[model samples]
Target: MEQFYLHLLVLLVLSILLRFLIAPGHAPEEPPLVSSRIPFIGHLIGLARYGNRYYVRLSAQSQLPAITINIFRQKIYLIYSPGLLAAAQRHAKYISFEPFAALAIRRAAGIKGNGPIVSSSSEKGRSSFDKQMKDAVHSVLLGEAMVGITRASVAAIKKSVDDLRSTEVDLLTWCRHVLTMATTDSIYGPMNPYRNREAEAAIWEFDSGLGKLTLNFAQRFIAREAYQAREKLVKRLLEYFEKCGYINASSFVQRRLEVERKAGATLEDIARLETLMVLPLLSNSAPSTFWVLFDIFSRLDLLEEIRKEIVQNALQFKPCDDSMGKPKQMCTLNMNNIRDKCPLLVATWQETLRLRANTASVRFVSKDTKLNDTYLLKANSIVQTPANVLNVDPNIWGPDAHLYNPRRFLDTRASPGAGGDRKRDRKWNGFMTFGASPWTCPGRHFATAQILALVSLLVMKFDISPVAGDWVSPRINHRSMALAISIPAEGLMVNVVTRKEVKGIDWEFQMMEGKA
Candidate 1:
């Protein structure tokens, strides 16, 4: 017993000594300021509550390329600068996506029969899935299906205005319901579940599942809600597909199945489909709508300018019909052309996302990688590229970085992010909101287009103004923060009145306008 005890004591001492040896040390000339409280829990509290402030404090203290913190039992390296982020992506193998994949796998889908969500066993499967999603976005949905969606959304918007005599409804909830209807019906097929209370309940159940899946605990164990919702939604979707003759013809489902077969991966199709909806629909749709409406309410001058522009340009395309008629053909606005003509609305949306986004990205380092001559990262170290820090940093964006100014993007002479002159061939270093590498957002165009459409129309129709007294800012919630994309961290609430008609015929005919 004495001998065994002696051996255990020696082993414990050796382990302690080894940890001390491997642990990071401060330089003789300069030491890191405000590292995580515990070895890995650095800035956890600060980040959870006051995310922007946490980075500001840390960056002010030290110009270190990267700092380490433990987030949910994982050692995450926080990369503050664009240069370091560049290095990390270029040497991606050294920084694997396996850790991030573990979370996606256990909570999102399941333990991959093949490999991680980000890493595919075969490049062909990746290419196939990418092509499928891309085709689906630009194909029938944006083409033939968009006409119905636009009509429905426009109709909903008009009704929403009429329903609001109080002029103080929760815009966030209103936007969520409207966009959910517009998006799901247009792309996924005509199940019109938004109006049906039971169907809406199912959606909430599905959303609850998604909420659970996103939790830190869920990542460690299993996403039970997500899985259960998957079964229910899949049954519904399969029935829809069969009725629509899409079971065999649909490219999206076909591609998903192919990818699974090729990579030997497993995921409930409906769950993955719903997860996809959360990003494109929820991330930008509600928050972007709120911010744009918020801006219109707060800034009279800017709102007037945009409103006039939308009236002059978009309304001119399709003349109002005298007789009651179903829209045979929807007026299509060339988004690229709109961007060329009206720069203000685009800039407004960009600035809103910059200010609202709280987190950067979840980048997993590959095993055994050297970041630079000064630093080295071991295999499977999680890296966080805090774009929020980079976006609002005064040094980078000038002294008035935090100030709300839409002109920064509109002023072509100025750089897009920094509010300076436009730089040719802009790269994805400073702007990491859409993310980087093989895992970048596919719905970027869709989100941008939807935001522009909703905002452009609303600005044209309504002369929004802020309610009396101090403004009610949104309640910040971490889950609402964009883990990989910029979204409202919590329910963003605002009060504003719609643009009342000043004795003029609205866009639609008299009866149609009344119906609206």
Candidate 2:
């Protein structure tokens, strides 16, 4: 009897082990609509190689409006139909991002607390970040913020121009530094680390590890080093804060302390604030600036049009000599003036952004929900609005969707598809460069203004073009192993020359005429 019992036990143990090895539990309860067989791994073989195209293929293959994907041991439901996806986005309260493992988030940001924004509905504060964090960021927006920011940004632009006067600098490489200076100065003020290249490098090193949720062995190894780098920088920031009288109870530190007192959050919370302040100001601004310059460098016809506008506007902004024979800071053009007059300048940028932006928007489902007849997403599903797919749709954007056409935006009245108001359009199919919903990027207006300023400055000052016959635009490179949320393909490398060198340049040259 004992021998027989042992034999049965061995069989049971082997069965359990086999199940685990096969990862049967990892399988989705609802099998994906679109199925593929590439041995042990499913679509992963193609996914790793092709990235976005893999999803595009799955969308095409599924035949259904939505498709299910098994990736990273999770069941992902991708909604391909723009109309259906938009409906899902409208009712986004049902889905949630809380299903993501804490370990995955920690691996990305090197810190915890369900990210900087804690939702009230969540048991562990795993609610949507669109409301809380985004609100906090835009809370301090004011005309005063613009004044300092514009001044610093303009100063940085002038400095970069001076530095690159004799050199054939990569516009993207140097413009990032200029943006870093402007943004950091505006946020951190006196303790700005713009001049400290080492500090800037460290910050980027730490930022690199953010946004991946996978914690596989290789990922963990990279995360370990990233965490170390994060710790080093966090320590430095803390020390800097202390040196700025934080330890001695200055206003800034005291304000933070007061928040801790009210909310009972810890020193970790303060650290989070530091990270939030730094990142929001750095990442997007740099890329936006780079793309504007890249567009100008690659397209000479577009560049000349923008140049003409800038020179005209610059001439208008050139103040008549005051009684003291001093030029005023600005020539009195306001926001309304900018919108009404320089449509081409504005349209060119909008067109470029549409071409380069990854998608329309992304929203985390706040609860488990169903969209349409097909998808039954679990509580914490990530439902992305297929902006890239929609933006390039031949049916919606017409046959010329792939071509770069600034006139599309310039002649909105003549546009067959001016669409509708943002919300209504978003409900169907719309552009999502700044996302949608309450969590839409608050700094988008500011970002647009700054990018326009940078572009205007470059156009006014430089004659930019691609490197001769080698001037073909660089293919957007998104296939790198980097897992950051807003990863941009490597920027287009191009050459820029001063406006004077161009043979048939059109410019009023207001700044040159009266240098105080």
Candidate 3:
């Protein structure tokens, strides 16, 4: 029996070696291959070791416009050339993003089988449900709809800021709590699920374990926390719907429910779908706010400059009488004017996104087709463009691409001959923080509004300092790859003091029209 087992092992090893030796080589028209040392499993190991950074490294090392990495039987074509990315977007029929979207909805939302959530057919062969959802989101997040949501969000944020009791607090946690409350209250109405602190905490717990959960690993052991959190949050969501939570919610939420119900989704299925919605609405803005704050506050000069910009753009004064019959001053900060008038603040926000965003835009090839009239792509293969690769490319972003320069988006004439006028335009084209069309984030406008409101209020009302004398940027939690936005490994400890200039002054926030 021992000899038989040894013989079987030897035969299996021989088979693997033979397979590697006779592996099919890449065709002349196909993208250049990144050679892997071990057969089948080498690229997977590399990905496991480096995470998304692996693709950026490969793009940097390879001379070709694209490279193909083989993981077991799957072929992932990683496009580095902007022209090829554009070509892929144009040829939307052959290389489709919907299949991947469907897979994500299934895995993350725990929806079983072919549901009506995905459109059956369309001109682009994409999901109609997705298009409806996108339309619904856009309708509610722009024009008058946007104004109403923004007004409500800014008010909620101001109230939370005014209610800050602790001088010293965890900056990330505080942002998450306040922003979660404000955003949810605005979108989900007064019956927001996150109003309960424990429920909000559970949602975050589920978010943290999302990578494992989506992979459908053994949930009882590997992703127990995520599993438990999902159950708790789902139960709450069902209750919210059962209690007619949709009555006062925004049109976006109402339309989503209407579509799902028409598709024969049960209360439980809708509850699961709502959990998916919570990710974009809640998870992204908090960390983005955290990174922006970290970048600005770490540099005192930048912080002071931004504060000045905020005051210049948004601050309005009111005259009043004090308790002792002395003249007193009060200020109201207008959120409507900030996005356009404050270039430095906008630049800081853009730079923070470029530095921290590491997600890839993924698509699956539905049919065999050629990309860029050069490379022949096989059917049923994956195609991807990692934003980190494009954001850090020296060709696209100049020599200082790797560094986090907050003023990158600002038009400074310090170097007149250095393409200063065109830097912002070029950078905008290369930046995929919100992704490209067809698959762009639907709630981007709302997310931007919420983030601006939160950050603007914090910088105006509070003076923040790190607990440690020197500030260290937290590492990105690469394990949470399932998330669209980067999550920090840990929260920052900071001391917050109310700004003296704004002390004893009644403060108010009003949302104005236009961007930001």
Candidate 4:
């Protein structure tokens, strides 16, 4: 019996060796493949160690424009070259984002089966379901609709800031609470699912569990909490729709629902998808706001500079008649003025995004295609463009790329051309904070406006300082896989006091035309 078992083990080892020996090699024109110590599982181990930073590490090692990572039977091509990325994006039909987007929607939104919710059908070869949805989102985030939403969001933010009676608070927690309330209220009106604190807590719970859910893990084993939270939020959303709660919602919310319904999505699917929408609208923005505050406050010079800019651009004081024998000062911030006039603030925002954003833009190769006239991306392969790689590339961003320099964006100079005429172009490029090409985020304008409004309000009305003697930036919590923006590992505790300059003043925010 022992001899028989030894013989069987020997045969198994021989068979595995033979299989590897007989495997086909990459074509001469294809990108070089990184060899693994153990077939199939080695790359997985590497990914586990590196997470989203895996591609950049690989790129640095290989110094290749593209590289193929084979895990089991799947192939993922990482495109590091800007030229190759542009080509891949331009060839939309052959290498598409929709298929991957559909899969993400199903996994993240908890939609069952391969539904028509993500399907594409061309009428006169014109519009697909994905295209229509994109168009709807774009339309709703522009002009009057955007203004109305921004106005509502600013109001919520103002109320939250004004009601801060406590001397000490956690910065991240405060930003999350205020930003979440503002974002949801603006989008969903009075029937916002996140309006309830329990429901809001559930949303965060669901977010923390996305990794298990995405892997299709068993709820009985690991994802029970996430599953329960998702179910609760979905039920609330479905109830809201059933009761016509969308009647008073923003056009963005109403139009999104209309588009989904027209695409033949059931109420249950819509509810699940709405839960997914909440992440992008709230999760990322809150952390981003926190980071913006941290960066500014950590450096006293930067904070003072920003405050001066805001005062010069957005802040205005109107003398009000007082009935209590004292004159009152009413302060109003025009968001339009802030957005247009505050170059340093805008630069700071951009720098923060570049430094902190770790989102990777992913797409599916629909057909066999050549990238950069070299690497052949086989059909059904995954491709990724990690924004961090682009944002930190020294060749593109100069020698000080890794440093957080807000003035990096402000140094645009036009060189002298023939006949002493100034050149039209600027040298700095490769800023992909919100992504690029067709897959760029549609809600970027609204998010930028919302964040700026909140940050501007906080700086103008409140004095904030760390409770601890000195400010130390917290390590990023990479464990929160559901969030695209990097979350701090811990909450920042700070003392907040109303700015004496803005005391006895009523604060208001207005969305001016042609601003965002």
Candidate 5:
């Protein structure tokens, strides 16, 4: 009798454990597993060798809308179907992004584990550090809070363009430098640490080492140079704040300090957290701006059309600069008008993202969840919505999906056919580069405005030609594993001469600002 009771108790305990890790027997089935030929390590090798393309190629192996990839015995729901991706997003409360965010900061900052779950704001003042930081970040980077920074950045861009002189330059180097300077000057105010040469270089170095740092596995030895680079930038940032740099900073920086201080974070903690804020400003935005310029310039017809579009639709003229005693109209380009009115320019931007922005919207399933009543995701699963896969999926984008077709978005829609009801399934979830609602990038509005402004000015105010003598698309740097949008594998040399017509004429950027 004693033995029977003990056996029954053990069975009950095991059942409870299993229940948490899996769904109930009556629940929906988990996504179908796509077994690999080489078994356990095949997918790992594929990822290391092929980088992001591994997932794209893997889709050919299975017909599942979503596949269960076995990563070292852990279930990773690699969502391929737009419908499943939407469902996962809808059940965000259970398939959470917060835990992963907290983990990323914990690992990258070298902080001791302080619990990996970022509490929901619904709990309000109970505020875990990550939750507080998220709230503070959203306060200024999203909605109406973005106008001040947008205005300042536009002014900076206008000044940079006005100073442009004919010169031979590397396109990537120029884009990174110009965009970083313009963006940081606006957000960091007068004491912007990135203005210092060492601090400027350090941001890129830290970013290069970010992949290893976020893995948090003996990163000091493996990514020594990058680790030191981060420390150097952190030191400069610490000095910036100690000297009351926040006094003149953008609301984004101000809110960051206010929230972290309230959470009793140390100065170092605040600096480290701010490091993440400075990331997209320098990292993603520059490459995106570079691609847009490269694409427009490579096709002269497109360049002229973009220039014409801006001139016709976005430009406003006022008699402000009559310095030469010859009447001159100072042209003001309304960047918001460029964003809204120029369909071709907007389409070009979207095409570049679809083709080159390789990223996955990753989440952690903290509780058993049903995705649109069709699929069940168990707790302990990792969910990844790979935009790289969906962006080029033939089913969603049609037969010519692999090619860059800006016309696809001229109607403000994807090429259609993402499965199921097809009409309703073709929603915003199909575009995952900036991700979907709730987890959508907070800085996207500013980034878009900045990129469009830079492209608009370059095409309109200057005559740029490749030093190679014609337009040749450089191959992407495939080995840049840590980055989402890869940079050019080779240098693109260009001659930039201010157009004769625009010389000596003052031009200003009229930025349209509202909700982010």
Candidate 6:
């Protein structure tokens, strides 16, 4: 034992010397290298043990806008400084996300080689998949198309909530089901595969296994469940497409089908690609909805305040079709008013996302590039910007950066999170949930509408109490950075009681034109 200790001590001393004295010489022109105290595999071990929070610790010690670290000698950069992040985004063409997108999409779909991703491309290198998909999806997520989808999703939320009977239910699990059905209904019409229970289960299983599945190595044995789940979803979706499901689907689905079919992709290939679309539509909203409600309900004062705000601003009483024998009175929830009139609700939603979302925006340096007038990002190097670190940065989001504070938006006294275009988004000025331009999450508006509708309508109509009698947050699954919004490792069962005020009153939702 003593001999082993002596050898390890010598290695430790030698590694420190080499890391400090020698590693700097290798990439002096690039960003300052923050090497590990251990040799060769130190950084990799740190990431495995600490996950992205490792970057937070490194940022604290180094205090650099951007820092470089090695993973098995491969240079990877982490950027946190708001200014530097903005500067890097300005060079989006050079630090392209397309390369990573192309590769990741192919791997996730279990496709081989360079195939057209739902659209024909004029040139290869940085394939047009990301850009083409972005344009098609974003075009419908706003204007009239966005409203149409929002109404459909809102209606689904109503039906789901109406079925509630004050029973014990897993909050996160329930959120996932509600969102899966609602989002899929809006995006895929009535025939969305997720409307079936088996397909719904498969989607979550597939998502849980996405990180391993994307590794694209021995998936049948290693990520067998995820791989199998992907095929399951693809098979169902393939059937949907074969039956001309897009005919009755929203313009969103119709538009994507047009783009993919024009590319001459087989129905199976299009089904595989379409499965990818369901991921973003449902992933963030479900987890994020859980967090926002959890944050509010955990604090009774905030819960009452938000609930009151929604009732006063958005709620309406109206007559509806009879459930049995007589005309029934329905409570209409004006979604636009919920979004525009209820400041506390919107602020809470943003704050919850700020704290819970742990996303890393990764880009492949397509060409050697200079950034912040100091660092040289060499071609083939990897660039990462973890939103979690920036979201909690004390320098940008104020001293209570780590706390859940919705007032940060209402105060009108916060930093712009970065050098933000203040006018574009006044409330969520500092949020990194939806990233910046070029690669900004295209479904952001539609997502916001859905979250606000789901959460506000929920709290307004139901009183949720943890079955344990107190709100104890579940241990978060921090290991998987693939999901931006970190989910609870275990489910939290809560006893949901429909408020006396909402009992026997049918609930409906509307997105009034020019009001939402």
Q: Best candidate, lDDT-wise?
A: 6
In order, what lDDT does every prediction score? Answer: 0.54, 0.54, 0.78, 0.78, 0.77, 0.80
Per-residue lDDT of 1-516 in model 3, one digit per residue for the tens?
Answer: 999999999988996786566555567788888877777777778777877877877887896778898876678899987667767878888888767776677676666655566434443534566777666666776546666777787788889888985388888899898888887888899788767988888889988777777787677578888888888888989999999998998776887888778666778878988887767777878888888888888888988998899888888888988778888887877766777678788788888888888788888998878887898877888998888788777877789988988676676413223665565545665677888655677678777777877788788887788887679877777766655567788877899888877787777776545534
Q: Which stretches of candidate 3 lie over 4 Å from their true place?
A: 1-25, 113-115, 118-126, 321-327, 412-425, 513-516
lDDT of 4 by residue, 32-120 (tens): 78766767677778766766766678888888878877777677777776667777877878887766676667776778864567443
Higher TM-score: candidate 1 or 5?
Answer: 5
TM-score for each model: 0.71, 0.74, 0.89, 0.89, 0.87, 0.90
Q: Which tens-of-lDDT digit does each residue in 1-516 have in candidate 1?
A: 999999999988885575466455433322122445544344567765664456656766677767765454445567776666667778865564544443553444333344423346666755565555456555534454344444454454455544444356566677766666555544443443234554444554455355456563643346565556555555555455446533433333344445444544434443344344434454456666776677656777877777666555545445454357533322333444344567777778777766665656776765656555555665556666776777776545557878888776665423345644334113234555666654455555555655666666555555544344445565654443444333444554445544454222343311122111
Better of 4 and 5 by TM-score: 4
Candidate 3 positional error at 476, Å: 2.8
Task: Give the poorly placed runs of model 4, Cα more than 4 Å off.
Answer: 1-25, 113-115, 118-127, 322-326, 412-429
Per-residue C-alpha lDDT of model 2 across residues 80-158, encoded as one tens digit per residue? 5666655675674565333443344444444545433332345444433333433344543433344445445555555
Assess candidate 4 and give its lDDT. Answer: 0.78
lDDT of model 3 at residue 293? 88
- Clash list (residue pairs), candidate 5: 143-516
In candidate 6, which residue ranges exceed 4 Å CA deviation? 1-25, 118-122, 125-130, 318-329, 412-429, 514-516
Clashing pairs in 3: 119-127, 119-128
Per-structure clash totals for the candidates: 18, 9, 2, 0, 1, 1
User: Which is superior by TM-score, 2 or 6?
Assistant: 6
Lowest summed lDDT window (length 10), candidate 1: 507-516
